[model samples]
Target: MASREGSLSVVIPAFNEAGNIGDLVIETIDAVPASLLREIVVVDDCSDDGTEDVLKRLSVTIPALRYVRHGARAGQSAALRTGVRTATAPLIATMDGDGQNDPRDILKLLAALEAPSGETVVLAGGVRTQRR
Candidate 1:
């Protein structure tokens, strides 16, 4: 089994999350095993909230950060599919960009994937706290 330090890709779907993208990226980086997931792809669904601008600014500093925009405004699922298809890593992880999911739990999910049972599993975490 490969350690969590192996290469991994994180895909985030954004739809008007100009306010959350930056912080989300930072938290995701902090949560992932540094040696494992150095690349993150943020797929925007043709957001009109200046998300493109934020990403443009971020790309300058975050070397592993990648921003992909839908030629037309596609839904979240489409954006997710795009990000996954474009990912360069053998393993891919996804998280919501609405500030609802905790990035710190990423490691736990990765650990689940490495379980010794040798069975395929999909790990999902639900938030009990409400955003309202």
Candidate 2:
């Protein structure tokens, strides 16, 4: 079963998430199956809040982490574009940097993608329920 499901690429775009990037990376690493995850790309959009620094520091701990540096502060779309272009994996995943989304949810998406007869499906994230 593991051999059938292809690799996954997770793209995390950050502008000023120095305080959250470390934890987020750790949680994301722990959340997904190591065999399924190809890489985790964190695109730094010229963040002034030391996000790039945080990512560099994190690379020491997270081996799967890859950093993409931007010259200036670009919007999320630009960051995402950079990430997607740089990613080598066929399955690309994206998430926000505010720490609101749970990394564990990635498993659900991966499972759904592995479902029989489910191909060429683009998963767009939608928040319609509250945990409370």
Candidate 3:
């Protein structure tokens, strides 16, 4: 197990994903251990739907949940960059908001990074074989 120093931040970039955002947020919160998670930052790319409202409500319920809405519609990459820029944690873990990525994989990635090894690994990630 890795040390729970509140060092990791989860950044989710969403665009018009009102239907999936709330569940994803709740699932992400539940998947990550409280001690290891510093915060969860959701960057909304000017979603026309109710994603902003959902995030606002979730933020009130989850202390670690923070969100930012772009003034204009930006693509997913731009949303990710914005989230990364706004994140406060040194270690950032990014995931899609459309529920394509598994929240539990975050722990696996963290464990892989923390594992002792003679050779350095630059990154650890899982492939998404099935799209929802």
Candidate 4:
């Protein structure tokens, strides 16, 4: 695991993903080392399928888990923007809320950022072949 002075904030944007949100949150917490992660922010875009309830319940179990809900149904970009705005960490990581993203990838990105390279790399990302 890579160590950093600041923690990483994970931002996830969700719509009506009640079925998948719980497992995603748990997996994300398990995948990220506690020392490296600050918090997991899930932005709910006015999901009607009890997504908020799931997040609230998960928050009780996971101290780092928090969520914000939009009053009206907003687009994915809006939800992501809200999550980023609410994040407290200096470094931010984003993922899909459909549970298709692998949390291990967040660690790889963090490692790359922490790596000592002469050239400055602002960001690193990749596409997963598998789809939900």
Candidate 5:
């Protein structure tokens, strides 16, 4: 379990995913426990499909939601790098803004990391049964 209320920050790299980004963020917030969640950082890659507008609206209602928009249209890797850099939580979990990745898996991965298996576990990754 996270030692504090805000230990996990989910970094989502989004580009023109305005249609599903809100749903993804809302689903993540609902699926992850508040005690372990710190924030959801969505780094927009200069999406022209009103992604910034949606993020702006969501951020106002969700204090944990942080929005970072790039002035130019950077690729996903750059957006991911930006998000990871901007995140404040000690632990960072990453997922797609299109809702392909399951937010619920975050808890399971965290459990594996904190299991104290008498070995030095640096990271845990979840493989989806059906890769979409």
Candidate 6:
């Protein structure tokens, strides 16, 4: 059991996810409770597919949404690093920008943590079955 309750931040590393980023962010926001959600940070790896514009438009309606862009193209690791560093919440949940991750699982993952024990939950992986 987690000893202390803290807000959550969702981080996404994106390259060319303009078509998917909007729906992903909206789904994530809907899944997380407003009280527990700190913010959702989307890090753009210098995508040329207008991902930045998508995020910019979404931010107007959702105050909890924030985004950062890399001046040059970087890998996923660098984008993840940027998102984590930009996140303001103590607890951060990372997912793919392509919307493969289900936001509904965020609470379940948080429930599995034991923050007071000085323990860290590094990777929580899931399998995707019956791909269409």
Q: Rate the local accuracy (lDDT) of all candidates.
A: 0.82, 0.83, 0.89, 0.89, 0.91, 0.87
Worst 10 residues of 1 by lDDT: 123-132
Q: Tell me the TM-score of each prediction against the true structure.
A: 0.86, 0.87, 0.92, 0.92, 0.93, 0.85
* Candidate 5: pairs in clash: none
Task: Count clashing residue pairs in model 2.
Answer: 0
Better by TM-score, candidate 4 or 2 = 4
Expressed as tens digits, the lDDT of each residue in 18-41 for candidate 3 is: 999999989998999888888999
> Rank order by TM-score, top first?
5, 3, 4, 2, 1, 6
Candidate 3, position 55, lDDT: 93
Candidate 6 per-residue C-alpha lDDT over 9-104 given as tens digits, one digit per residue, 9 for 90 to 100: 899999999999999999998998888888999999999999999999999999999889999988999999999999998888998999888888
Every model: Cα RMSD to truth: 2.3, 2.4, 1.4, 1.5, 1.3, 3.1
C-alpha lDDT of residue 124 in model 1: 46
TM-score of 6: 0.85
lDDT (tens digit, per residue) of candidate 1 on 59-81 = 89887889999989889999999
Kindly indicate the candidate among 1 and 6 with the higher TM-score: 1
Per-residue lDDT of 38 in model 5: 90
lDDT of 4 at 45: 98
Deviation in Å, model 3, residue 101 alpha carbon = 0.7
Superposed model 1: Cα runs more than 4 Å off? 1-6, 118-132
Please give the range of 10 consecutive residues that has the lowest summed lDDT in model 5.
Answer: 113-122
**Residue runs of model 2 more than 4 Å from their true location after superposition:** 4-6, 115-124
lDDT against true structure, model 3: 0.89
**Model 4 residue 115 lDDT score:** 46
lDDT of 1 at 105: 69
